[model samples]
Target chain A: MLNKVVIILTSILLYKVGGKLSLRSQLLKGILEGCILSIINIQPAYGYELSVKLQQFGLSDVSEGSIYPILLRLQKEKLIIGEMRASESGPKRKYYKLTEKGQEALQLFTHHWTLIKGPVDNIIEQGGKTDGSN
Target chain B: MEATEIIELNNEKRTRLTEHNLKYYEDMLLYIRLNGNKSEQQTEEVLLEMLEHLLQAQEEGKTAEEVFGDDPKAYCKEVVEEIPTEKRKNQASLIMMVILQFLGFFAGSYGILGTALHYFFDIGSALTTFSIGSGLVILGIDLLLLGAFILAILKWIKQSTFSKKEIKSWVEFLQVWAISTAFIGLIVVIHFVMPSFGKEVSIPTYYLAILGVIFYVLSFLMRRKQNF
Candidate 1:
């Protein structure tokens, strides 16, 4: 009886949780990923450079693990390229440069965000509630 | 110090850079290597330039540990990743739930293809059975897929890095991709077996089958990359 009750409650809780994870969380991801894209436009950079610039822009939780993989994916997608060299310290140093594909992707992403941002703002302004913008 | 000696000393820990300083060295190394200058003097100049930038970054007032948030130049990912929702869905158990559900959608639907085949052969009458059975099975898979998709979303809601919402959207995207491929598979089945029945099979059916095979391989690669 206890196990049955627990399963029902758990399922209900899970459903409630799942339903809420929608546009907001992904939009946040888009913003951060887009920021990474825009930065790539300025100059080729490394993971640390990205992390640093992101923090300067008021992003606090960015980690090297997340950024490195995104860089790798961007490189794999032909959106970016990695330039590796032997460092004086002995570790291989990799720099990330934006490809034409990356530039095009960034442009499209920025445009999409602009379109979404307006309605999102209107919705939030309708109520003082926000989907965790900070 | 001689170039070789300097490198040896640096390696031996005489020039041990703190984690704080290490990333600076890396960036300068990347800069010098990429900017078409690799002479010792140019390397040294780039290193100094990077070191200065690192110090300047600090003077802007951010701690090393919270640099993702505090540093003016850190990646915004630190901010996005810190979202509380992403953390919950990243758990092995939850990720497993999504993987199982994702696989279950197709695994549960495999029988549909077989049923469709049995009816296609006798097409004189098996048509009713195949149409009815395939439709029902597709319905069940759709429901399961929908339930799991929504569940994946809810699971990722709060965390920044892998918020349940992102998971939900990704699952939804994957499902759409999966269903379309299943239809393509159905078309492929029709091409080989249907051609034997003397009906003119369309050319696009063959083309779609080819595309389906390519996408199947690509999907496998994507799944592997995601560790799904």
Candidate 2:
């Protein structure tokens, strides 16, 4: 009973503080990278633009700072290619485009996402049935 | 617009944007440097790319906080964590520094011990034992100091992040060069000016001074030309 109370209090404290993301965000990070790659698969983008696109997709917590490193890592892994090209607005911008490897990775992520999503969707849709039966 | 005109326009805009966000950018970069072990080149490239994004955000009328996020440290940590740790360069430099440090300590200890035995204990019969012994002690102190100085520099290098700014500024190089020149000048003045100072203008001293200047200039030029 004490353990349960402690757990409830700790969760309340975490929620009140609110800055820290739940465990879900930690799991979402890897999926976010793959999602970022898929976004790049649509169009080549600079880091900031890519970040804005992520925010547009309802990931308001995503920061521009987080994307550059991920882009660099993807480039290093040969999944994407970045090139410095002259921008009309300012100095040369490093634009990232998906490589063939990145496309393959995106395909793999999509295939895996579907596998997870289909079962989860079914289970979530059956939530009312389960509760009603209970 | 012509290519040159477009380039010039972009340059002007970038310069203006840099002026506005320079301090914010520098603080973030410094945080990265102090927290992580990264090569100077890697740091420079990362900064350059980051600056591009910062400029883009400025163009969009976004606040720095909005663009970089509230927790800059966490963002930097997240980015830095993605970079694969390179053992080769860190290991090589550490090995070289350790070797040099050991040599300094060994030589200093040897000098202190040898001089103590010869002069203080009178183990070796030498005529000018007293004066030579004092000089050896000073030499030993200098060697120990040199070792400590090198170790401090290595520690600073490990902690500090290097960037394009390091390359552009010649202050560090100039400080080293100035010290070298002043030391050589002082030695020459003492040898040539002071009548009682009987230290001859040795061939080895001349060669050493010449070699020091050559290396200094060569390194300065190389650092200027490329990211070292």
Candidate 3:
């Protein structure tokens, strides 16, 4: 009986965690391009390296391969440019760096993020407090 | 580097992937490659980049699923959406190359066979008869049929990439046989129904062979210059 109860609770917990992960990924998708641009702005990085950095910075929910599409979009928009270069461990890799346009875009994204972050944080915190009071 | 060069490099580098990862990666590769109208250079470059990234992830002991997520087909669609289409000039050049090559091969084979029949079997009069109007109509119909067939085949291949069912070789063979029979049947019908109204120009079968050679050579040069 104890084992069955434990199994049931564990399953519920796992389900909730999976649900949160999906939700988190959905939320992250919007801001991911900006995050990528910011990282590239700091230093030029290849696809895998960029993913590692994002994961190291605690954005582990972001799928590592999802960056390629964003990279392609940024390239098409002329915001970033990629150059093929020799890699340390594998075959030649395409290293991406921001163009002037990309830098400007990054700045604009940063500005917009700043504008929304505080308001969003405040609203969420107030909502939490209201729930607590109730 | 040229697109062809990148493709060659990809072929070499992709061997490093594990069997499972290679299969997954190749599905994406074929999906992107089969997407017509995209810039070849960009397509190849992005494919190489993906291969390199996958290799790196493989080194870290991560499965392709972990890196790329489970829904690879969806991810491929996203990638394809961003890839730019080929320039008009490049597309035109490609079309010209195909048409020229087709014309060359058809004329060349007809010339060779006609020349052989004329000389060996003394069938000279039949070999010399040429009708420009019916010839042009037949060429037009052939080109249209060829284009449609190519598009259908490419669409079929693209749709099959993520399909769950196992495609049998016999089914594929039957499809090719059907298309081939249809193509030949249409040509035969056109020859029977269409009137030969154009002035009859009697030319030596050898001359037709020469014209075919010239077209074939032009196509070869264009292909080399374009490096497609």
**Top candidate, metric TM-score:** 3
Rank order by TM-score, top first? 3, 2, 1
Count of clashes, each model: 38, 0, 0
Query: On residues A1-134, what C-alpha lDDT tens digit does candidate 1 reach at each position?
Result: 33334333433422333433354433344466678889978987766667778878887665433454355445546787756554455544456788888999899877766765575456546444433442
Off by over 4 Å in 1: A1-26, A85-92, A129-134, B1-228
User: Is 1 or 3 the stronger prediction by lDDT?
Assistant: 3
lDDT of 3 by residue, B1-228 (tens): 789989999999999999999989988999999977999988999898888889888998999999889999988988898898999999999999998998899888888888988778977544567588887887898888878877887887788787667789899789878877887788778878888878778887778788899999999999999997
Complex DockQ per candidate: 0.03, 0.39, 0.59
True contacts kept of each: 0.03, 0.63, 0.79
Candidates' C-alpha lDDT: 0.47, 0.59, 0.83
- Give lDDT tens digits, candidate 1, residues B1-228: 223433443444414445754553443233233321123322332233233334444566533333322332233322222222223333443344444544444433443443455556632322222244444455455555555555444333312232214346677678667656665565455434431222223232223334444544555665565443
Q: How do the candidates rank by DockQ, highest first?
A: 3, 2, 1
lDDT per residue, candidate 2, A53-131, as tens digits?
A: 9989998877667777777678778898877687667656668899899999888777766665565566557766766
* Docking quality level of the chain pair in candidate 3: medium
Ranking 1 against 2 by lDDT, winner? 2
Off by over 4 Å in 2: A1-22, A88-90, A125-134, B1-22, B33-42, B84-204
Q: Model 3, A1-134: lDDT tens per residue? A: 33334333433422224432354443455478789999999999988888889899998978888988878888998999999888777567789999999999899778867766675566555766655675
Question: Candidate 1, A84: how far from true, in Å?
Answer: 2.7
